[model samples]
Target: MKHVYGTTALLVATVALTGCGDSDAGPMPGMNHSSSSTPTSAAAAYNDADVRFATQMIPHHQQAVQMASMAGYQATTPEVKKLATAIKAAQDPEIKLMSGWLTGWGKPVPTPSHGGHGGHEEMPGMMTEEEMSDLGKQQGSMFDRMWIQLMIKHHQGAVAMAKTEQANGKDPASIALAQKVQAAQTAEIATMQRLVGQLPVS
Candidate 1:
């Protein structure tokens, strides 16, 4: 019975850690007033792809929020933490943005993000489970190296998802958000690549 309780507690902790974003972190960038002043009325409401993108992306953004948040605690350099800070700041507001878009359009907000990494396999640049585990266990230079690598990969995945929405989504708000994601993640990818090159690990 004690063992069962311990296992349950461990599972809860793990779930809370990975499944919830922003435990010890600040809000993502541009997280101000959720109601965009005079929401841009789109030609049509959300589509299936819009729903898929928002539903899938809430957790994906949350994961970036989670990893970016961890950097402040574990990273050694300002650049690493700066990039992490940027990611955390940017994603938080976007999560609310996407959620609001859904609510305004009478679509459902994303289901609460679940366990396991996001479900989009075609999306670019995600790290494997082994890599995430290795990243979590590392410290100092090792932590810095792993964080850069994983975050680069994470940003890449986000960009891909945004691209999918850009190509297929109909809603004005979702498409605008997707475009913003493309610009942001693309810039971050370049920055992350440069940072990783400077790291001793690779």
Candidate 2:
């Protein structure tokens, strides 16, 4: 009977030690397994596609913010002003976020296209100086109509870039951001189309 109790006690002790083993003695909860190939940081995981997406998007978003900023003073319709406000509010922060990601990856944040930054290919939906100058000169209903049209074209370009990122980018965060950009811009495009329909002829 004593031997039987000793065996039971030993089994119980073993189970208790296993259950109470130091939680931090092995790999941490979120840690990658110890391997020579593990990335040292999330930024180290970014590839060329991720770098390109961030660089392209920074300038693209800057232009959108510039356009939206004009609506505060130039847009006629209450809806146009409201939509512009929402757009600027949403995109300004995203510009910062993408810039942050680029900086973390030791990549150069592209200059805003308005700065005449050279070498980079023209991003889709960027307004030429002539087009932007024309838009800037309009007022009242004319301004509202032109703004909606240009913004829709701008958003379509963004959606295209985002789709490319989704398909080709290897970084998880960049891919997730690309998915978000595509979904949001597609919805905004629909909104702009509806606004266009409501505008009076020319």
Candidate 3:
């Protein structure tokens, strides 16, 4: 009876140890499963083209925002001021959205050049430093005309970039954003053209 009791005690101890081991092991797999799947799923959804689109478009939109900001104080025409407000409102969020994409993709987010163009002047529809400076100096109807013209050119550049992304981008979200940019900027360009005709020559 003594030997039998000792054997039963040993068996119970072994089962308890095994149960403890399983309980400790259980959470590790779940932790790893969650951590690994999230990044993989996000990374898999984008490709290099999507990264490029996000990277380039961030600064591009920043410049547009800068241009729009100038209208707040300098523009005399109500229509130009309204359009500028709209441009800033639309592009500011887009800049943030693309920046978020770059962060998620493990890509570097482009910093805004502030008053400068971040050396992207060669890009479609980007204004040179001189042009932007000149626009800044103007007020009244001259500012209105110049702002409309430059904004039209800027929108054209954005549309061109969006088109490139639409053609080559792999991520559905990026492509959808590209389509949105294309449609919105194209419409803005038409509106600017009409405004330019109505405004007197600066």
Candidate closest to the true structure, highest TM-score: 2
lDDT of each: 0.75, 0.80, 0.81
lDDT of 1: 0.75
Winner on lDDT (1 vs 2): 2
Q: What is the per-residue lDDT of model 2 for residues 44-106, given as tens digits with 9 covering 90 to 100? A: 466888888878888888889999999999998989999999989988877777877777778
Cα deviation of 6 in candidate 1 (Å)? Answer: 89
Stretches of model 3 off by over 4 angstroms after superposition: 1-41, 114-122
Pairs with backbone N, CA or C atoms under 3 Å apart (clashes), candidate 2: none
Query: For candidate 1, what is the TM-score?
Result: 0.72
lDDT minimum window of 10 residues, candidate 1: 28-37
Cα-based TM-score, every candidate: 0.72, 0.78, 0.76
Q: What does candidate 3's lDDT look like per residue over 1-202, in tens digits?
A: 9999999999999999999999998976665454333322145557787887777778778888888899988998888889889989998988877777677777888886443656575468887889988999888899899888888988898899899889988876687788999999999999999888998775
Q: Show where candidate 2 strays beyond 4 Å.
A: 1-41, 117-121
- Candidate 2 achieves a global lDDT of 0.80
Candidate 1 structure quality by residue, lDDT tens digits, 67-143 = 88789899998899998998889989888877666676676665434536546464456555677678888989889
